[model samples]
Target: MIPSNILNIFTNTEPSDISYKEECLTCQIMGSATCLVAGAYFMSNLPFLGSNTSVKRNPIWWKNSVKGAGAIIFALGILRGGEGWLWNQEKYLTNESK
Candidate 1:
């Protein structure tokens, strides 16, 4: 059986208990890092885009488009990573809880 702790990382909803907060934080950080790396990779021209004849026809336009997409991904990673600190009950609890 998959452990609740492990499962929680993949799920979007937080558990009622705060015990898994650390795991959630770690998951977010890792996800952020992965996104950032992927963004960087996409932004870079290191990967050969020449495989497709169409891409070869307009390399500059394709590179710019890819870079723009990478920038958006990088921004999303930054936002996701920054939310790690807001998981506490005091900050995250709804108004109904107050």
Candidate 2:
């Protein structure tokens, strides 16, 4: 079984000090953009950091692993950014309408 401390890192049982709604729009955009850019970079497999001789010798499995990571990051970016932007727009629109 996983230890409480280790599981805590994986699970967000406690509330965050700063709620998502309180986060600034700029921060949210930057966070999402960073994730998306990083994901794309990884997916591209441009040998950004692995241009070394030893890295070049890596097998196909390693490349596949990187791509998988990229896909996850890209999805995370979409979810995080989409939720924030959509929610804010909804809130603003509701307030304006009333």
Off by over 4 Å in 2: 1-21, 48-56, 85-98
Highest TM-score against the true fold, candidate: 2
Candidate 1 Cα lDDT to native: 0.71
Report how far residue 61 has shifted in candidate 2, in Å: 0.6
Question: Against the hidden reference, what TM-scores do the models get?
Answer: 0.55, 0.57
On lDDT, the leading prediction is 2
**Model 2 Cα lDDT, one tens digit per residue, 1-98:** 75567667889688775633354568878989999998898898684455545655766788789888998999888877986356557765554554
Number of colliding residue pairs in each model: 0, 0
TM-score of 1: 0.55
lDDT score for residue 25 of model 2: 68
lDDT scores of the candidates, listed in order: 0.71, 0.75
